[model samples]
Target: MKGQDYYIPAAAMAIALVFKLPALRNNWRDPLLRSVCVLLTLAGAVFTFAAPPTIDAVNEWTGIPNFSAPLVYCLMTAFSASCLVLMFNWRGGPAEEIRATSRRWISGYATVVVAIMVLFALGDAPEQRLRDFDTFYANTPYIRVMIAAYLLAHNVAAMTMVAMCWRWSLQVRGWLRGGLVIIVAGYAFSLTYDATKMSAVVARWLGHNLDDLSTYVAPPLASAGALISAVGFVLPLVCQRTSDSWQTWSTYRRLGTLWHEVQSTAPAGTPGVRMSWWSPAEIRVIQRESDIHDGFLRLGPCFDRRHRDAAYEEALAHGADEETARAVADAAMVAAAVRTSAADPEGTAAEDPGEGERVLIMADGPRDLVRISHALRHSPVVAATRRRATTADG
Candidate 1:
């Protein structure tokens, strides 16, 4: 792969990591968050160090030939371990079990990373091979073992990821399942990467040169696999958050009709709860609902059960379902109460409560409030009732 291929993914992972930093800071002890951060960090490091330009620069800077080879191998090994640890945390078993499993994986990969460094230190590779280190050193003593060890570690991680994600994907649904399926595909690419790299190395040991496979084919495959897996990890989180925000905003909008109607009849100079413009959607929704219920309490004296009963019958006659009819009835009564409250600001025209007449607002929750709001905006029966009330008032 070209330098841009490596650097672009590195930059992308950096951006993703930046986005998660705030949440990570807030919940640093959260196992899943920690795992995600570690995975992104290691993945970015792997890509950044694996780029040909960066490899040459590191070798030149350190004055150690092919120093980047072991460094990149160590980072990739750590990245693989991070992926497994993330999966363990994400799958969510008992906390202690997940911690133990993650620790073991980390320890094993740490050993491999150390072994790669030791082998590289012992091996003599005065000639620098930035892009084809594995192929160039395939016949060297300790370097050969170092190359094989890293590849075997990477291959095992990829196969394990594919199997785990595939099995888990089948057991889940929605965005999580979709993400797992993509993860499986990503790891499948990773396995192909290992296969090509290993193939070239093995061919070298047999005195044949398939150097192009490791030098060219394998880099692109590795880059593609990492980028795809990053997307798989991020897709569910981004999409789920977006979906939740949309739902909250939608609820806030749906409640607007009823909220406005009630607010219009609120007594002049009554104390009101004010929220900041930048409040979260959920907070805004709760505030609006609270204002609506407060309006209902203020308009309680103006409620006439007869208006609701008549509108309910009219709605049923017009073929509204029972639930819709109930919504329409509640909407009609709210509309009439708004008119009555407007005419009698002192509430002098309020009727005494009839025994067994339940207060409509108190009888239902937020969902019913949304249904009534929708009915208030669209129900023909409620519209007719509002027209009649306006006429009677005029």
Candidate 2:
């Protein structure tokens, strides 16, 4: 493979390792996270060791020509085994069930590793073959069998990961689903790597040469698969935080107008004089909601139940759905509250759940608040109510 080809997986592996370091350090007890970290580290090593320059250097340092060939292949086999083990962990079941299944896969791949070593010992390959290793050793004694065994092991692992990822993704959603699909796509490229290498080996057996396919086609496929698989494993954890930040920021932005309108009437409701520029979006949303409710409480003396009822019926008459009408009514009430607070900021009256008003239990949570915020932005009924309140005050 070209130097550039090796650089891609190397870069990907480095990024994955850096991204996962914090999780690995803090959550070492998590089996799945540990497995993913090991998988990425091994994948990077495989890419680095498989590069032609590294192979040549290792051969010269060890004073054994072609020694790095089997060493690199062995590392590749270990990388594949780690990948399957990671996948098994990801498809979680009961602890005992997973342990038993994982042990079996470990034993099976262990046997493959031993067989590869034995075959390499008995084989005769004096030349250092980098890109065309499969075809170069196709007719060599036990080396031929060893090459085939390694390829077989790789293909099996790749296929198993592809199938498992596909099935697992179907059962999940959001970032996890997208991550698994990307993993499946990676292994699909692995299948291509296996196909091209095997075809070249078969061609050698038939006394013909397809060295170009193994040399030119297979390494790129392997490199791409490793990079993608590593990314797939990391995507969910990274994306979860990213998606949350986006949603939180969106909520903070969307509620800005409503928060500003209410806070103007109840300056005392604001708990702080200075807002932190880098405060989390969730914190900002909670603070804003608190200010809104505090302002609403201050307007209790001016809250006219009849006005809210009229707004609700008007929203319904305008063909708003039940939920929409309720939201519009809530927005109108808040708008009126803002006006009332402005008219008499010092009015002292216990906040009453107006007649026909839904007594929103604490369990109702943020749904009602969100609905009212949405209506404040787009509900025509809220605008009409504000106009009526203004005219009445005048």
Candidate 3:
């Protein structure tokens, strides 16, 4: 019988419409994202129990009186609009693109939702509740058959959702993608759950009704969990970006350090400025400064003074006595100068996550690196050594 089925479908309805909302349509980075996701969860929950019809009949597990059409639609609808508002208002997409791809997701899901609700609402016509999965599945094929179409279609859609998630898993970095891959695997496993039920003979062999274990209830629970887990894919991306944004200063410091490092590296031909040229003592200091101020600049300039002081203290500790301390202090100053320069493209400090000092020679013509080598050959130290060796030979 058509019952509380509409609530789940209705939620899908609200989210689909939200996809088209002006606010969420354009903005992706808005801060209210978690709230929106929570609403989605609520909507999913409402859909679950609501779709099952209420019956005065005793449930196998609860032995409690069950009521048909679970009153989910009416009760959940009361909050659906508000939930939609919350969802549509949160942010996660480029302004040019819809903030969340979930908007489109809801829209597609809504087709089934609307059909399920409409069927449930219509099936209850004559102002009476009709209770039977058989009637709903088979008899309705005579009417608009919208519900039937949606049910089978949902299977396909579920498969498609898993496929999309699978494809996305290939593109992103980190374990987030792998986590999503697991989620998609769950959906895949779920799709096969119904069809692979134990045969009646097998059920007898196993001392259980396959239907008892293979009830309609379990899949939805698992599916919902899978959907929620799939949502984690978005979280890491959000947090990592936020954390990175917060570290702009540290990133700047890193780049600044790299510049000084490059300077200290000196040209390769002339005992060059690379870390390789520095005594082990010097490289240790540069690396230490790089580690300390890693992402500090992203928070903007109005930061606490204590951080700067902390950095100074850190430098001193690493300096490890007079000469090294002097060297460390010089390294820190060079990095600080880079932080102030704002010469980095778009004020981003270093392009790489870990920046080091090195001279990159870009040449349009013949080997330019060799020219520096030739110049190094004629330097005072080399020339004087050559003369001394020649006098000894003579």
Candidate 1: the clashing residue pairs are none
> Worst lDDT window (10 residues) for model 1?
351-360
Local accuracy of candidate 3 as per-residue lDDT tens digits, 296-383: 2331221222323333455456444443333333333333333323333253443433333422222222122122222223223323
lDDT, candidate 2, equals: 0.79
Model 2 off-target regions past 4 Å? 20-36, 88-107, 114-126, 135-145, 167-182, 202-213, 228-241, 265-270, 273-278, 290-304, 349-363, 390-394
Task: Give the poorly placed runs of model 3, Cα more than 4 Å off.
Answer: 1-39, 42-44, 47-108, 124-147, 193-217, 220-231, 234-394
What are the TM-scores, per candidate, against the unseen true structure? 0.91, 0.79, 0.39
lDDT of 3 at 347: 36
Clashes of each: 0, 0, 31
lDDT of 2 at 315: 93
Residue range 1-394, candidate 2, lDDT tens digits:
6776786778788887888888789899888888888888888888988888888888899877677877877888888888887877877889888778878887888788888888888888788775677898899989899889989999999988998899899999998999999999999999999999999999999999999889899888988888888788878867887898888788777777667776777565555545699777788878877766765665555666666788899999999998878878878877776675665556542143443333321214355667778888788889888888777655
